[model samples]
Target: MAGLAAAALLGTAFASTDGLARTGIFGSPGLTENDTSEWLNTGAPDFREVVESLRPSDLPLPAGRSWQPVIDQQVADGQREPARMQATGVHAAFAHYAVCVWDGEWLAARQAGDTARVGRAVEVIRGVPSWPIFVENDGGGTVDWLRSIAEAATHGDEGPIRQHIRANCTSSWIGVDQ
Candidate 1:
């Protein structure tokens, strides 16, 4: 009975919503170093610069609201096929950066006991489809670590949450290894 209950919980946790699978739990196949190098050769932006530019307020929410509409609009504009081909690597790097920001926000909110901010941060995290892709693209084990941070935040466990961020968030940006 305990095993069955655990399985049910896992199912619910991993289930896809709106056709998008929840990320950070299961490890997807990672990209090879060669693949990353080739992608970078396509003129990707500097990973550090991209990471530095990201702010938590730049993420969009479900209710037609965003902290920075102009930045979001720029992202939206890059979704075209031509732009996508050129900027795929850059976008992936940004995804990793976003996760790091969200993880920090979640931790801060948890420490402050700010439930509203916590929920908002988690919502932004859930909306990011890049986590899974990051894992799939050989980003790093930090992808799973980020998921663990999310789970810890949900359970109000600050210890592990802080530990994971300290251990993984600093170097979590995709393409950083390259």
Candidate 2:
């Protein structure tokens, strides 16, 4: 089932601004079918399940080393090379990792009733400067939507928040169906 979803998404060709159809997996240039298959089989986690079953113990330490630095460096490089910014797959890769981490933290905080942790996660989500880039790259405002959900989760019962996540969040990195 995952493979089918991945194939459906990754198999389709997208037209570039230059009016040419580029064929590649996950909208990334030079990605072969085997590469996509490997990612779908191993690299991509079932994020829907992850968020649904989140626990504080499962969360990454907020102060610990994170992928933020790598993401930041990618954005910095994009600044130097505008073409890199135009690469939608790169942005998706960054968003995939960042959102997974942020969502885990947010969900875990809510589960533990840790308002401070929740607030911190929300702040970080909101402060991500690459949000606009994600949107431009067809990420569909996922970061912004997650931020709003996190903000709302801070106010009251977390049941609704969890439901929202379950309903909306999917493993986009592997092209899973939402």
Name the lDDT of candidate 1. Answer: 0.41
Across 1-178, the per-residue lDDT of candidate 1 in tens digits comes to 1121121112111222222111222312253221321111111233223323543444453332333433343344332211211123434434544555566676666667888988987776655534444445443444555566566666766665455445544443211221
Instruction: Give the clashing pairs for model 2.
Output: none
lDDT against the true structure, per candidate, is 0.41, 0.41
Off by over 4 Å in 1: 1-89, 126-132, 138-143, 170-178
Candidate 2 accuracy as TM-score: 0.41
Q: Model 2, which residues run further than 4 Å from truth?
A: 1-61, 68-86, 128-130, 138-144, 157-161, 164-178
Tell me the tens digit of each residue's lDDT in model 2 across 1-178. Answer: 1222223224222223432122122333365432231111111123222222222232233555454443444444333333211223333444445555565666777677888988887776555434543444332444555556555655644554455445434443212212
Q: Backbone clash tally for model 2? A: 0
lDDT score, candidate 2: 0.41
